[model samples]
Target chain A: MTARIGIVGAGLIGRAWAIVFARAGMTVALYDVDVTALDKAREAIRQSLVDLKQAGLIEDVEAPLALIQTESDLRRAMADVEYIQECGPENIAAKRGIYAELEAVVDSDTVLASSTSGIAASRFTDQLSHPERCLVAHPVNPPYLIPLVEVVPTPSTSETAVNHTMRLMALAQQAPIMVRKEIQGFILNRLQGALLNEALRLFRDGYVSAEDLDKTVKHGLGLRWSFMGPFETIDLNAPSGVVDYGQRYGPLYRDVDRQRGDDDPWDSVTLAALDKERRERLPSQGLADQQAWRDRRLMALMAHQRTVTPS
Target chain B: MTARIGIVGAGLIGRAWAIVFARAGMTVALYDVDVTALDKAREAIRQSLVDLKQAGLIEDVEAPLALIQTESDLRRAMADVEYIQECGPENIAAKRGIYAELEAVVDSDTVLASSTSGIAASRFTDQLSHPERCLVAHPVNPPYLIPLVEVVPTPSTSETAVNHTMRLMALAQQAPIMVRKEIQGFILNRLQGALLNEALRLFRDGYVSAEDLDKTVKHGLGLRWSFMGPFETIDLNAPSGVVDYGQRYGPLYRDVDRQRGDDDPWDSVTLAALDKERRERLPSQGLADQQAWRDRRLMALMAHQRTVTPS
Candidate 1:
């Protein structure tokens, strides 16, 4: 039997989730309060599936599109669904209100997950009667193309809920990591934040330009990172593996950290400088076109990754 | 007239430089003190060129192969070359000795560059007679495949030398970023180190496993990084631009930074655990095979990149 999944938002992320679930042969019930937003979501999901088919990431768009159904009523959307992925706003009050309404209509057994990037599940889920069944299963933007999901669980979340979420994400072909504790920005954003903080500092200090800094990643460090993570990269770097690599470079990293200090380096002055350079390269008017280019490139990269077997 | 390039040290990196120069229609003089190493380097260069051709990274192997010549005499190898890429040992004494010999043989007009992964150019090039012409042109390992070259200049290096090196790297189809001031690890390793430090902390704290941590990169953050860098990525992320993105997430990044105080977290216990997991995924015996896979994948990615222009 096809599993029924409820998506409780029709924004960009919500539509992407609909495609992911539908493509995986699940019956997706995508719900939105706004009728116009729901209508737009239907068209967007259809176009995204077509894009996936054109990129050779999906076999055919028809079957997946057929599996997705739009629902206007909140109660009907929650009806008979085993799992519900909430893709609402990033506001704590908005999420809390939605959860309160959702808890009343949904079965106690239905696993509830939020797609919040910053807010932790504990903040909002603590108010729910069945908080054990609720957690945060945050997916990267455009989840249909990129397959990283951070499966974060609150303290009240049951083991069963976390395990089931992991299984469902794997079924959808998403690489989900179990984030044991709810850290700020989760794992992806934190790691990204670390890199961005340093990048801003470097740019502000006049060490390198915005263009050159980007080049340093795309052309240099990013090449290896495309296949391996930081740990594995260093693991393969040294002769004796991770320990040897640590011994050689740990102190140097310590020195860098000392120089970095405890303060956040994301100053507005640096951002303005970054914005000026970015605008020079790509104006605001051209952003939509550039984003489309990014999506196409991402699709092509995904297609290429499918061809190579992971080590 | 084709530019002449001299590659000192016929090791793996040296051979890779030979390919980069030769493929760009430059005459290459490859040198090594050991005869057997040079013979092996010649065969390796041939095989790598063949691999690149098979991967569609290069048009034809014959043209590039024709441009490379192995020379036994140091003076003959350095004769009239416009640029000399030194891929010698990381040891200070060894580099100093090589620069002394190279300074005597090579014309003062030639731009001398080292491929040291960690040592700053100022440390080794300080004693040289023509320090103004010397700089560090550190390329990621296997430069024939990866295009990032850190063109680092010492305090004594002249602007003419730096500009010429940048021009030469661009001609060879390698992406070169200028390191305005000499810093530890240059740009690539330092950025990599920051991420590694955080990753170690996460793994040690039991937030995520080694395998899953790598997935967070290869499957998620790394996908976008392979093409556009973090800055450009955030630039296009929000509606307004990078400034808007900063406004939304800068505070969150600040929170994460505070939590991650000044501490070097690459502990031995965590490394041992990571090593164990890595060895399990890729046993020591299987490393050679995995490395081959990595090279092949890099070649394929490079080929793909050629098909699409950066946004």
Candidate 2:
């Protein structure tokens, strides 16, 4: 009686999704165009499950991996599946082809979700016969550790599509948010862009060094942001809270926005400075080791969050 | 042999700062224009210290509170102090007047820093004879738990003033970042604004609910961000890590910026939706209690972070 899920494109993201779904007690049918990719993806998914098990993230991993089956036929993956997660490439033409193929074969009750970051659901769903079920359930990279899945819909998309997608995502052990309309980068990407843009502006203007700039977030504002949003954080900022903090500091942010009109810091001077500072702190050779350490650290953090709060 | 740190205001930030400096083993002299404010501030500081003790944030409250001495005279607060942290009103006229008064009283060797969030250092330090000693030392709302202090300097400001202030902040158990030149909103505010701005845009454009927007951060990015920074986070994102992740997603972020023209959803509407969601999640009458819960949760999270990670 468990929900049966189908995942197209058994690459890194697709395999990750397979793990997520299978870990949540859903039988996943993962498919790829090439049989070689399907073979490799199965091994990768197994290895990743082992990693997750080692990190104490998953239990009964062998059962989940055993539940995931690969079929030579594309339509075989979607047959009798309650949900389908499409982690196809960013190309519009490829997505169109896949959608067309999927629409022709996917079950009427199946929720067809795209893992696309930028493409609007309307872009491809405009031609779909069952466009109501088509939406973007884009997840941040390494979705297991970071569980923000942006569920963006189009005008043709139905409310049931949104709710069912959310419910199915919950079953997958992912936090799903509905995007009422289609936007460029969804939510997480755009929010992330804002920070990167401002960091670049500060560096380009020669206001701070790259290392200190990063530290400003890691040691300072980030300390609070790790727990609360900007709005809630601002609320507790002043005596009267949000309104007071806004009245005092809104003008300052407005001025900053004014001063930061269309400035790109990827130029030679700024890049050189960034490289210089980056080299001083993190060597190119040690980048790999540092990254492994970061992943381990993230694993530890995730373990802490899971045990302290709810996983 | 300890740093003689003089604070010009006795408000919450200033008092918490007194605890920070005193706990770090320094002589903190506090002064206020109104004795009534000072008296109330004393009670508030004592209560806060007790709360910190209860929260296990501070170890010895009595000794730290004992290190603070009240002075009625401006010269007494300004004289012979290694560093002066000005936490007066953010109004330009008030700061200008204080700068003039402190200029007449403070020795040239003493560094004069402000806790102003809005006004630039150049604006208030324009007419001061020793403007070289003036700089911005902005901190988060509660400086004790959150240790980020943004140090801003004008073009005419001396390097020695910057270095001395940095050293002094270090002595106070604060992580200070020096803004090489004055820019709007400094580092933390701008980065935060960037994220909030994009969130506002996504909401205004009918992309996501306000609650979902906040969760995108709190659950998604905030998980790792609580421990590492955006740059460091990105560095470990891809195979080659940050540089690789940047190369992959940087262009995509730029494209997102290009698409967010003035056609997004409005903040007021989103805020209304957020308020509605907030009320549903927690009764409006219990907001104050919820905020206490939030702080306790933060403390628990911090404690968990310590047990999980070394740094």
Candidate 3:
């Protein structure tokens, strides 16, 4: 029998998840209470499929489109589903209510995964009868193009559930990393937050401009990071490996960290200034157009990546 | 007459700078005290030019190769040079000595730029006769492949020198970002250190493995960052712009930052363990091969970037 997957929200992330599962040849039931949201999701998914097809990422968009079924009724959409990916609002109340509804319909063996970027599964699933089956499977936006899925398990999350989610993510052609313990913002966001904190501090202190800082990443560090992680990058950087790299530059990094004393709150004033600078470069009205351009650039990069093998 | 450029030291970075200048149609004089190091640099530069040619980055290998001249005498290399890129050892004493000799030989109009990653130009140039012509123009490992050059000026550096260096960098086809003030690690390394500090702490605390952390970056954050910087990324991410993104996620990042209290020292035990983990995946003997592979991947990426227009 074909595996059935239930997506509990027909929003942006929910629709993207639908494409991911449908592309993997799984039956996807995308559910939402709002008929307009469901209608918009269907159109958006169709457009994304066409984009993917044009990027040479998909063989036939129609096949995947045919596999996804959108329904306004939650229970009807989740019927006989082996796994449920909750893509509800980030609010705790909304997540709890949706998970409660999902638990009432899902079978005993169904794995419950939330796509919440920051919230832990325990917060929403503690009162449930089967909290052991719940975990967080956070993904980057537009998961069909970017394949990383951070699988974070709470203390109550069972080992079996984690394994099942990992296997399912791999089957869906996504890169899944296991977070052994639940941490704030998970792995990817924490790393990003770390970099952003420093970037904000630098920009605020007048060390560099926002545009120049972006250039530093896109042209410098980001180039290496695009292919290798920091560990691997440092490992290959020095003569011997990571140990040698640490011996050579670890003190410098330590000094820089020491210099960065106290986690200063991201002030609104600095953010406003940054926003103004960004607007000067790209006005508020041109944001949507820039976003579209960003997506196209991402598509082109993905296409290019597929053609070359990682060293 | 063709513009004459002098490159001090024939080490890895120096040779790369030689290639950068030579490929820009300048007559490059690469200087090193040791004859054997100069000989090695010539062969390495030739090999790199061939690699660049194969990657379709340059039209012809011999054109650039023929433009570079190796010299053992510092005075001979500095003769009639328009700009000098010093790639000597990163030691303060060594830098001070080299600058003294360079000041004695080079013309007053010639700009002196150091390729030092951490040391500020003011530290060594303070004693020189023409401190106004000296500044730090740090580059990534291989300047020919990675185009970013951090054009950092000391307080004493003249506006003419900064403008000349910036124009020179642009002429050489490199991306140069101005550093308004002197700081530890400048921009790129500080940002890198911030991320690595968080990564090390996470690994030490047993939240995630070295391998998984890398995947979270290379596959997730890196995919977007490869083309755009974090600032531009956040700008395009939200509906309005950067301010919208900040309003939505700034608190979450601040919470994460606050939770990361105290800049803990990167312990040796953790680094050893991390190194062990990396060596298990890539043994000590394979480091050189991996580095070569990284370069090839970089070349391929650069070639791909040249073909596409950034949005």
Which structure among the candidates has the greatest DockQ? 3
Error of 3 at A231 (Å): 0.9
Q: Which tens-of-lDDT digit does each residue in B136-235 have in candidate 3?
A: 9999998888899999999999999999999999999999999999998999999998899889989999999999999999999888888899999888
- Order by TM-score, highest first: 3, 1, 2
The true-versus-predicted C-alpha distance at residue A189 of model 2, in Å, is 1.3
Each candidate's lDDT (Cα)?
Answer: 0.89, 0.76, 0.90
Stretch of 10 with least lDDT, candidate 2 chain B: B261-270
**Residue B7 lDDT, candidate 1, scale 0-100:** 94
DockQ of all candidate complexes = 0.76, 0.46, 0.80
- Name the regions of candidate 2 deviating beyond 4 angstroms: A34-43, A50-56, A59-63, A70-72, A238-246, A264-273, A307-311, B73-79, B103-106, B238-247, B259-287, B308-311
lDDT of 1 by residue, B16-42 (tens): 999999998999999999888988988
TM per candidate comes to 0.97, 0.89, 0.98
Is 1 or 3 the stronger prediction by DockQ? 3
For model 2 the TM-score comes to: 0.89
Report the Cα lDDT for residue B97, model 2: 85
**lDDT tens per residue, model 2, A68-185:** 9987588777888878999899889999999999988877667899999778878887898789888899987777767778888888888898899898888777888877767677
**Candidate order (lDDT):** 3, 1, 2
